[model samples]
Target: MTLPAIIDALQCGTFDREVLKMLRDGGYRCVTPTLGFWEGTLESLDSLARWRDMERENAELIRIVRRADDIRACIADGKLGILLGYQNTNLLEDRIRYVELFADLGVRVLQLTYNNQNELGGSCYEKEDSGLTRFGREVVEEMARCGILADCSHTGDRTALDTIEHSPGPIAITHANPASIFPHARNRSDRVIKALAERGGVIGCAAYRNITPDWACATARGFADLIARTVDIAGVDHVGVGTDFSYKGDDAFRAWMRMGRWSRQLNYGAGSASAPGAVSKPDWLPSADRLSDLVPALGEVGFSEPEIAKIMGGNWLRLYEEVFG
Candidate 1:
């Protein structure tokens, strides 16, 4: 018998009917789409509304997933469940109450910062990492109270650690890799990984090329090897996949992601200055359709069938139930 549908814990891309179809064809039952990459209240509201409209428009093929049980039901019924998420807390606009507001809006995951300093905390790319501020602590508390999962993907090291320590519940580094594997600024250290696992949190190993050694060698098997190593370090129960896949490869999409509305000049944050607008995806796992390749790759790397199942989706499912429910 086939395994249950997989859940991609973190995905940063445009969500539409085509994307849903691709996920369905790829055997995904649930995906948490990050519609609020750098969006504030109005922008996040608009994006969330658009997705809600899409859910309504394609009710037969997809539905909004608010609870953990919805995931298995969607898979059993042959539909894709969209779990709304935000990559930054810009939508809160400094008010702690907005955490509950956005939580009610179907945002299950909320990243504290996105590549730069925000009102709440510092980012990994900053010249001096300032860590989480007083307000940031309040936001974490409110998120726990409101049943929203705290994420620290692009947050500064100090801030990420602060959030993990300050949070009343487990927090996630939703889309980052181990810095030990490939020393990128965006990757987390073993210290952080251990702290996260100790707190009952999960880390989703990212598939972005910049986080790895080189795009040419970052094939599906190579990525799976990285995951295997991560599992060895963080334990299989504390690791999952967060592909960070972007459907749009155009310069416009690149500009929006890199610069957002923060600057007019190109900011080569993750990508290179020479190819600032180009998205370098591995051929072996180019899109959501190729995610299934990880199963066999994980097996080849010595992950048992049960372990592979947990790494693929079961781990994330448990995290969602604990945090979102």
Candidate 2:
């Protein structure tokens, strides 16, 4: 079967030369590599510089995408287009003007919060969801004006809903699952999903273990079923895949993701002390190169050719066009 331009809406990995080759060889046209989780402005800026250096060093394999056309250009030129995204808005601090500054620097997407509440709003794990703060509303507006896509994947339900209502254009839940299916704090509830769809946003179904409906049986079929269920809730056009694949990270990285220097005590999110690291990736779709395996699995689960194409990358392309253009 002919494939569409495959875009991994969110991938957590070290975009090394090897990973870039894997993604290119795996038939990924464009990928959004998440950056700035628990990072301050200086650190995030350094990360962006590192990505730029990587793009230069591996010019044949990948290029940084700054506009909607860059994605198509990379596809035609046979190079992976990398869209740098911030997993949290902590980098912005109190300076709302930084939105346009980073946008100018090719930061196309930014999530309002990670696992903890920030100046913008509350996180999913927060005991009290502060919802969208007044500053958060301004941030959303500035993001819309700057053509930066606002993501609510790790945001509180109330904050997510408030964001959907406040944003001038469609936003994204870049990497998450439906709470109805997985019952995890990282997953979105039905109400949030419906509101996101109503506002023309897309939810990229995540393939991480803890959020999967059946983690022990994390097969391609199960992943496809997750996508199908999301389609039922948000329609096929608003459903896509965000693998959340972490190609290279140690236990330190995992701990940092959960704890993030905010606490001295370890915080095992989605895992306990016994399993104090990232949940295992699905056995079938485990890495960047193995993403194509989902095509057949999606077909097996009753997705039409066009629907599968949409879920694979077409939906993300449409969203990028609308938001990044």
Clashes of each: 0, 0
Clashing pairs in 1: none
What is the per-residue lDDT of model 2 for residues 207-261, given as tens digits with 9 covering 90 to 100?
Answer: 7777667742367777888888889999988999887778788888887787888
lDDT of 2 at 24: 92
RMSD of each: 1.6, 1.3
* lDDT of every predicted structure (CA atoms): 0.84, 0.88
Q: Could you tell me which 10 consecutive residues in candidate 1 have the lowest summed lDDT? A: 211-220
Cα displacement (angstroms), candidate 1, residue 30, comes to: 1.3
What tens-digit string does per-residue lDDT give for candidate 1 at 70-168? Answer: 987886898888888888888988888888988888888889998789998999899888888999999999999888999998988889899999999
lDDT of 1 at 167: 94
The candidate 2 region of ten consecutive residues with least summed lDDT is 209-218
Best by lDDT: 2
Candidate 2 versus truth, CA RMSD in Å, comes to 1.3
User: In candidate 1, residue 301 scores what lDDT?
Assistant: 81
Stretches of candidate 2 above 4 Å error? 215-217
lDDT of 1: 0.84
